[model samples]
Target: MASPQPVDIPSSILIIGSGVFGLATVYSLCKNPLFKDTRITLVDRQPFPTPDGSSIDSSRIVRADYASPPYARLATLAQTHWRTTFAPSYYHETGLCITASGPEQKYVPSSLANVQALGTDRVEVLTSSDDIRRICGLEGGAPGSGNTGYVNWSSGWADAEGSMRWLRGEVEKLKRVEFVTATVSQLLIDHTTQTVSGARIKNNSSTSTTTLTADLTILAAGAWTPSLLDLRGIATATGQVLVYLPISATEQTALQSHPTLLNLSTGLFMIPPSNRLLKVARHGHGYTNPTTIPHPESPSGDAITVSLPYTHIDNPSQSVPLEGQRSTRTFLEQIHPSLATRPFAKSRICWYTDTRSGDFLISYHPQYKGLFVATGGAGHAFKFLPVIGDSIVECVLGRTPEDFKGKWEWPAERVPEESWEGDGSRGGPVGMVLSEEIAKTTSKL
Candidate 1:
């Protein structure tokens, strides 16, 4: 079968999920004169700021720090918006210290080389644990957590919720979009034509469903995208762990200006504190929650299993597994020994729409017409919140940036999950089953 060409813009576009990608695209479309006559509609399960959405976090690292040149360059471009008018108050130039102590240490230097090549003089190479301690402000000196690392003053972190709220407000100010708050049950596919018209959505849990048809449909649902498709090895959802602890005013002041510390070897990272809350999290391959459900496009209503996101929205009381909690605690003890004994205030499972190679799965569905996919964040799309929409719009017009043409394009075929080699940035545990690990829970908080 011949591939579908993004030759012309659709008269109406239906976007599911109002997260970063959705809002960004809305903003870009409103600004672009080419889409002045286009009717744009956005539908999501929740209102503007999704509670369990990955983009609705307190803080997200904004850095041109990646092992891949394409992403590194793209991130550098996005940072320009971050430093300027794109919610400038929410972005902090606290810097980032990326370290490693295990075989995954290779990612540290490789990322360093890319960023340094970008011609930023703010790069400082850390050859010892003491070097990390000095720059990252780890008074306890974490010799065990990370041995070698580098600090990039050009890097920083952002208040994710604030930024998203700001972006949503900006998009609404244009008044060019119709935002509908509804839960999309399935894509409205015309099987005979092999075209995805739009989506069948309902309010919360109402049995009655309504269809919103359009000339084009873009699925930017983030981690929940796999649950709407038969993405096995192509793209899957993984749940990452996050543990937050309260800090005193003085403690917050001391750690507020410190650079974010990340250990590539273990995937443990600590971003600077905000609102007197300190967060310890991991960026590694997260736990997979395999679920069997009727395939969205199955005419016969056959069931298929896929790794889907099970967030607080699904189970409000669900917490991170014991293994994750223990790992995060160990990371905190290594970085800030004083904070290790402090009781954790809260913990949550953050989901990521991860791809096999860690490259974003952004492309028109090869099998379905009028359907474009824009997900597979791989735990990193938050930094590009500013400029990613323009890029996605370009891809929608069949003009993918030269740098991301192959990187963001959909895979020609699906390979077995175990045989996949990620973008070479992930580290720590692999093949963790969420249920098995949750069953081993032995912690109160």
Candidate 2:
């Protein structure tokens, strides 16, 4: 399908999904005097700041350590805004300590240099095992064990749920944007015009379906983007496990000063304790819900709450899978043995819409005019929050920056099979493809 030609700035915009990207788009558009009259309606399957949305997580990393220059620049911009405007509660500049073993450490020097190149003095190199221990409070630091990486004071983590809620509150205050609690069933398309007119949404409360009309529509549905737009090849939903350990008072005090630690070799990233809870997550090859079933325990008898549609199981009870729990325990045992045996405070399977390239997909649909996609985070778009919406605005106005022009466009095909194989954070091997019955019967693995 040929890419649809651009049209004039839209006066009526319908945005599906109110996660970071959707809220950011609303903020960006509403702030512009030129779009002061634009009517923006944002809809989500759940309520504002949906708990299951990838953007609505416990915490997200805020850093300027990307090996890619454009991303590095974007992170630097977002980091600055986060520190200045979002400092008090939402953003925490606890610092980030990233370690990679030999050979894989190629990105380490460049990552440090990238941050420094941003004209900041926040980067600190840890030269020895003791430096790692004293600076980050992680154990067993040897050459390449984590002692070799640097710590950047400017980089840290943000309270993701808080940040999204804050943004949603601000967006709600805007007169131009209306937040609707609804699920988008399908895109409203004008075949003759070859344009997406709007969307068909089901009100969560009223249970009534309404076709919302708009001059343009933006799909910022996060991990559910592929399911909404059939973007299987270009993007796929993958789930990552997050396990939280409730730390003791003493352990919490000792960890209060520790920075977020990321191990390149193991793809494990650990965030410092916040409210006595510490989070540890793996970066590669997360799971996904390709199929779904109704939850037997759902208050709404027919509510489908499973993460994947491919799964036949309709169980609603939530817990970390055995695999995830094992990984979390093993990593903690290696680095912080004291916290290894602590009971899990909570666990969740966070989903990410990963693209072949770790770059986000923000573009116009090739077959549908007026449909703009602002998804494919590849699990790392949160740090770019401050600037992402502006970029989307630019895309709508045909002013996408040269740096992002090709990088965020849809790939010609699903990433080549070999390339899709886990390459660090880009994600790992494809997960099991279960049958319908298997999906229904399968419990926590």
Candidate 3:
């Protein structure tokens, strides 16, 4: 690790948020030989090596299953990068199984077709229930259960926190990168020039604030991003639940032998933990607006709650809710009866800041110069942290990737009409609607 230097004090770039994205950005920038002269400052609310802060747990699976080719391609590239450069023990290639049931199961076919058209080797359509069972180690299908399958060898889970820790260490070794523990309150703008100049940050402990100047700023604050982008007119919607449960000794053995399973048919997926536990959850359902909900100072120990129109974001540092845990329990009971008797070992409530369009927002604010916004990851952003980090660096350096074109169109419209509703089952009505839209868009290409 290179020591911080006086010359490094004046950074050309500043990144807010220290989770997967921020740390990855620092690593990427520091590795670029062309940018060795550039100084980088990474700011976050939590200090390094702090267990209390929210970092991604590495035991879970990572994958590249998506209805869109761009995402699938990105995931494939990221997996490749992880396998070659990233430590092998940090990631596991358990394979991904996306199973679907019911009338909506047709979406699986459509999604597979879209991915196939992209000509990527990451996805393949499974045609038989027997194949699904054999590949995913699933048994006993319920009557009326419609089964459709998609398998991608490149998709699996990785140790998120472990990856972050490794990358943070690597970045800290760089002579140009600095880690600052401060909560940014606002982005300072030069009104006369109509450009962002720096940031107004409040030290978490002292309550004292300071202004740090930078040539460019990247907002990767996850759920809290919108709050700091007050001048950019950016907003975040959050509602995400992660449930962890202990597996019975027998079931644990079964899961260890089984592949990572994503039962789209049931709208839930399970990952066998490295420690003999199981992690499961539903996707696309628990979105909330962080501004409305109170940010808890610490993790909460409560049951998951499920109120209709569930749309409130909680602080990342807080505890899991009772409703989310219960819902996950019920989901597991229905999907895997063998695990029904086991109690929840732990649960945590997390938030996903979503854009109305169901796509990530990464672009310079239309009205603010030198200020870049990156938020609205929806539910599937974590696995792409490395790629997202690369993109963040590009955006901060005033370069936009071809895939991100038109990302910040003015007068942001309501979420695309094809947006899907939240459901545990894989092929729900909303997913089908989005599938149709995807088909139309892909056909044109």
> Best TM-score goes to which candidate?
1
Where does candidate 1 clash, by residue pair? none
* Model 3 per-residue lDDT tens digits across residues 1-445: 1111122222487888876666777777888775777768888866764343334653545665666556667777787877877745678786777777644655566556755665668665766666766676655443211266778766678776777777776676766777888878777776667777778899888978998788777777766664555412233444455667776577777766455766665456677665656787655444342223222111232322111112122234343444445556655555566665677676554555555544566666666666666666666676776677787666555565676555532224333322533212232122212223334545654
Prediction RMSDs, each to the true structure: 1.6, 5.2, 9.9
Instruction: Assess each prediction's global lDDT (C-alpha) against the native.
Output: 0.88, 0.73, 0.59
Question: What would the per-residue lDDT of candidate 2 be over residues 1-445, giving only the tens digit for each residue?
Answer: 2264665778899988888788888889988776877888888888766767778877899898887788888888887789788434788888998776545556677787888888778788876657766778776554324557789988889888888888777776776777778778777766677778888888777868988889989999887765556565677777777888887788878886779888665667788777888888877676655555333222243534333322112334665566667777877887787778888987776777777776788888887778888988887888877778888888777776798767787666665423663324322224633233234445533
Predicted structure 2: lDDT:
0.73
Ranking by lDDT: 1, 2, 3
Candidate that would win on lDDT: 1
Candidate 2, superposed: residue stretches over 4 Å from native: 1-4, 127-130, 139-147, 292-315, 416-418, 421-445
Models ranked on TM-score = 1, 2, 3
Better structure of 1 and 2 per TM-score: 1
